[model samples]
Target: MLNRIETYYDAVPRSSARAEEFGPLTLFVQEGQGWPYYARPALGHEGDVPVAAVEKVRARQRELGVPEAFEWVAETTPGLRAAVEATGLTVHEHPLMVLEGEPLPVPEPEGFTVRLVGADDAALDTAVAAPFAAFDAPVAPGTSARVADRITAGLTRLAAALDATGSAHAAGQHQPVGTVTEVVGVGTVPAARRQGLGLAVTAALVADARAHGTELVFLTASDADVARLYGRLGFRTIATALIAEA
Candidate 1:
């Protein structure tokens, strides 16, 4: 399962980025304007990674003007967290979850509809930008416009929970590699929390993945508490996902 997850990780960035090797680390460089991909332990490379190797990867990331970020499965690369932290980077741990049971039914908020967002959808901007705001990232100018291109290319699929006024209050996306898909960036606006808008968006993405022939779905929750929320959708923690940023 770890190998399969690593393959999915390696493939998700290929549609928009190219991989560069730095020892056991692979830096995924964005080929055009879009969110920058981060560095990760190369597929199949496991065990203790040296701090020097991590330092080299960060140096290259700085040179390329990309985020000095790293993500890896804790069990797959147990020593990577220490090596990354030795470089003065801060690391965060998340629940690495996979869908192992049926998605429990979740109801949408009142007057809200959840569905996939199309390339030409007029609500694309709001849908795409919702996650950024939900995650507390400043919605910089034109930061999410490439979502349209991504949708058109079938590289990703976005789903949103929209109000009767036709505005998105929650959004998420699933990037697929064959029958396996990874759900990412699913969130609801601060004003919409506790109303099940975020849960509805996630359920929609999970359903869409199955409709498109996806056989596996997984994601990393921000924390243990949040993992319990995703548990409502039948996702269970299988490992700890470690992320480091300099």
Candidate 2:
């Protein structure tokens, strides 16, 4: 399962956008997207990458003008965390989770419905904007256009939760949530959270993935509470994710 998840993550940037190789690392770069974080360093199961290899990864990120960041499964790449940290980068650890068995039936919460909007510009705008508002962060310029590129590339399926009046209250995407189908970008507006909209949208995506023959679904939660929330829907922690950022 971890191997599959790792493969999925490695394939995402390669499949949808531009992927460049630097020795043992793969760099995903999507320029002009305003979402600098989208440009990532993907290190797979290459065990104990040499310090020079790590420097090359950082050099490539600098050349691409993207943030210096990479995510890897520590167990898969032994000593990688120490190597990255020695170079003045910070490593953050989190659970790498996967959905197990059958997902519980997630009925649409009352007064809300899940909508599959695909890549429609207007609908995408609402879907993209809701998270920024919910998190109280400025909507980075050009993010919508970058996301649209991914959607139009047939790389993402966008979903959202709407109120009775049809206003988008929360949104998310079901993409190769790493190398397998997984739900991501699940977020609810402050006004709409705690009412089960997040679960509703996620469940909708899970059902859609299963219907399309995707058997194993996976995602990385922001924290334990989010993990626990998905746990109720059948996701289980399978490994730990180590992320290094400069």
Candidate 3:
């Protein structure tokens, strides 16, 4: 399962980013409209990685004006954490979770409807802005070329909880590659949180993935508490997901 998950990790970014090799690391660089990417242990690589190699990847990220970030599974790349820490970066640990069986049924909480967000939906921009608001990111910029285009093409799937006004209160997405899909960016706006909106949106994504033949679904939670929330949706922690950012 871990190998399959790792392979999916290596495959998803390749569809939308350029992979730059740095010894044992592969930095995924996205030059266009997609979200920023990061470095990870080169696919199939094993054993210790020299600190100097990590330094070079960081230097290249700096040169490209991208985030100096690296992500990997702790059990698969045990030596990377120490090298990342040696560079004075902050490393965070997240629970690497996988769906064990059918997800627990999550009925739409009162006052919100959860469904897949269509590319040309009238409230598309509002849907895009929802997660940004939930994460307290800068006000979401105007939507021009949206990830929803990819959703429409079947490359990705976005689910959101919308109020009566058709504006999103919570949103999340999953990207399917073959039989695997990774659930990411699940969040609910502060004012709308604690209403079960996050779980509803996530459940929508999971159901959609399963209905479409996606065989593996997984995510990395922000913390133990967040992991427990996902557990309610039937996800189980399988490993530690690590991220180091400068």
Candidate 4:
């Protein structure tokens, strides 16, 4: 079972990258999206390029008209940070936490029941898409429809992939009150908030995890409310990550 949830920083770039070159280092670029991510050793290894190389990547991103945000691991060297700073980047800090205790046995709520979802289930898609709606950003042109389609498509693909790999799990029967996938991302809907529904969903996921021999539950927390919620469910902060956005 996965221990810590590998973060958005580690995978987002890689996920976005359509083409990559790897040698003693890795350079990943999402040409259409204008996102560029490069990585190399910190100890001045021969294959590793200087901090200027990263700045060059950022420059390429700028030239591509991408939003000027750079996401990277905190383990990046001070030299790299200084170079990025000189080029005008601001750092944003956040912590990642993992739940360590045995999974809580999910109990049925009044008027609701928890159960696993089938491979064809659509509630999982709706469950994951609801959070994006919570963000009040004006829907970009075509984004309102596209986001839902994207979420649905992504969740469908994810469900199929997990089913093939035996990684999918479902809870909250019929209407699917809750769910948890093998991959790191999990959430309850906006309509499901405050009624302890989030906890109920999470507990359902945890129960499935425990039955599957998972030793830990890992998740990243951004909001203090979610952080406190996770804490109440036995999650503890594991590490802090600093992101530099230009």
For each candidate, the alpha-carbon lDDT, in order, equals 0.88, 0.75, 0.89, 0.45
Point to the candidate with the largest lDDT. 3
In Å, residue 9's CA in model 3 sits off its true spot by 0.7
Winner by TM-score between candidate 4 and candidate 1? 1
Residue 32 displacement (Å), model 1: 2.0
lDDT of 1 by residue, 1-246 (tens): 877898898888888899999888999999967778899989888678999999898888999999999988888888898899889999998999999856889877788899999999988988988998898987766656678877888878999988888799999999888999999999888988888888888898999898989988999999988899999999999988988887
Q: Mind giving the per-residue lDDT tens digits that candidate 3 earns over 1-246?
A: 999999999999987799999989999998576578999999999998889999999999999999999999999999999999998889999999999899998777998889988888876777677888888886534342557667777777888899999988898889999999999988888998899999999999999999999999999999999999999999999999999997
Q: How well does model 2 score by local distance difference test?
A: 0.75
In candidate 1, the residue pairs with backbone N, CA or C atoms under 3 Å apart (3 or more residues apart, or in different chains) clash, namely none
Candidate 4 lDDT over residue span 1-246, tens digit each: 221223223343443464333222244555443214544222222332356666666665677565555443344433445555677778666556666666445445444544444444544444334334444222234423432443444431211112223322222211111133322334444454455545565666566555645554565566666777777777776664456675
Runs off by more than 4 Å, candidate 4: 1-16, 19-51, 75-83, 104-109, 113-119, 137-192, 209-216
| Candidate 2 residue 131 C-alpha distance from true site, Å | 2.3
Better of 1 and 4 by lDDT: 1
Considering lDDT, where higher is better, how would the candidates rank from best to worst? 3, 1, 2, 4
Model 2 misplaced stretches (Cα beyond 4 Å): 31-34, 37-45, 141-153, 177-179
Residue 140 C-alpha lDDT in model 4? 37
Clashing residue pair totals per candidate (backbone < 3 A): 0, 4, 0, 5
